[model samples]
Each structure stands twice: as structure tokens, then as C-alpha cells.
Target: MAIIIAGWIDLDVEDVTDIIASAKAHIDGAYTENGCIHYIWTKDVFVPGRIHVYEEWSETADLQYHFDNHWYKDMGGHLRQFPRKGSQIRKFRVDLIEPVYDPSGTPRADFFTAK
Candidate 1:
């Protein structure tokens, strides 16, 4: 099943401009991984020193492989340079997948593919 790794990190580095700049290469490298569907790290508009992270992998095993990959390791080390108050990252196992809109473009809350 596909999985999502999502959360936020609060840091002591008031401005994360340099951190984000340095992470671009590593972030791009992660996208080259076969299992990566989407990966991103962006700043929270209303919060200073906060970076939001989101990553989706084809499967749990793929995410495990990423943990040992150079891209992940490099990003970890790069971010380690800055002081952080805490982080709340978590891995989510997906149960079902569906689009928010149907053919008519109306919003939907029920799972069309599972039933």
C-alpha cells in the first residue's frame, strides 16, 4: 500500500531561507527515486521557523529504502545544523484511494474505487 510521511518541524533558526535553498538539491534527488510520488518541504505561511514536510511513496518498503538513501541522509544532516525545538513527523499507511471529484466534477466523500 502507498504511504505518506507528513508533519512539521519547528526550528530555532528564525528564517529558513538558507536551509530551504540548501535542501533543493537533496529534495530533487529524492524525486528520482522510483517509488516517490511526491515529496516537498515548504514554509508555513503564518508561522516563523516552521517547515512543513510531505512525502508519498508507492509502498512502505520504499520509504524504508529512502531512509538509507543518500538523499534522505544528506537532508537529515543538512537540517541537523540548525537548532530545532521539536518535530512531529509520522508515517501514514493508506487504506483507500479516491479522487475528490466525480465525472461531473461534483465533490465526493464516498470511496468510488473500493466499493
Candidate 2:
């Protein structure tokens, strides 16, 4: 099972390009780290200044390594320069991973939670 971390980060800045550029080094470094499955930061096309972050690690130890890395600290410092409007991040322990699109060409909603 892999550990999944995903979230949204809303910045006060009007443009997210500079922020992304500043963190590029750290992002790249993260990809080279051990047990890193995926680490991505993407801008919201519909909402400027909004950035989405997603990460997956093979184990908790790997995620802990990321938390203690100097690059991670540096990235945090760079991001602090831009005031944040709001942010939300969550970690999940995934037991099973599946694609939303099935082999039969049907979209599956098996993971939906009823309200």
C-alpha cells in the first residue's frame, strides 16, 4: 500500500508562475528521492493563483524523509514569500488502487461516499 497526499494551495499573488518557478528545484529534487511515486504541483486553469499539489510515497518512512529534507524547507521558505489565501492538504492510506475508467469503457463510481 502507498501513502497518498493531496491538497490545494491558494495564494494571494495574482500569478502562480513565479511561485512555481521558485519551487522547481525542490520539486525536481523530490522526484529523485527514494520511494517517491509521484510529486506534482499544477496551476488551476480556471482559478488563477491557485495551485494543486499531489504526492504519493511507497511508505511512511519515505514521506518522513521528504518532511525533513532541506529542499523541502527551502521550498517552504520560498512559498512563504507569497501570502496564502487558504490551503488544504490531506494524507490517505490507500489499500487498493484502481482506475476510474474500467476496461469495459465504463466510468466507475464505486468510491463515492453518500451524503
| CA-RMSD of model 2 | 3.6
Q: Where in model 2 is the C-alpha error above 4 Å?
A: 111-115
For model 1, how does the per-residue alpha-carbon lDDT over 23-106 read when each residue is reduced to its tens digit?
999999999987999999998878889999999999977888899899999999999999998899999999888889987898
- TM-score top scorer: 1
lDDT against the true structure, each candidate: 0.91, 0.87
What lDDT score goes with residue 2 in model 1? 92
Report the CA-based lDDT of candidate 1 relative to the real structure.
0.91
Provide the lowest-lDDT 10-residue window in model 2: 106-115
Question: Which sections of candidate 1 miss by over 4 Å?
Answer: none
What is the lDDT for 72 in model 2? Answer: 75
Q: Which candidate wins on lDDT?
A: 1
lDDT of 2 by residue, 1-115 (tens): 6999999999997789878877898899999889899989888888889999999999999999989998678878888988899999999998777778776868888843322
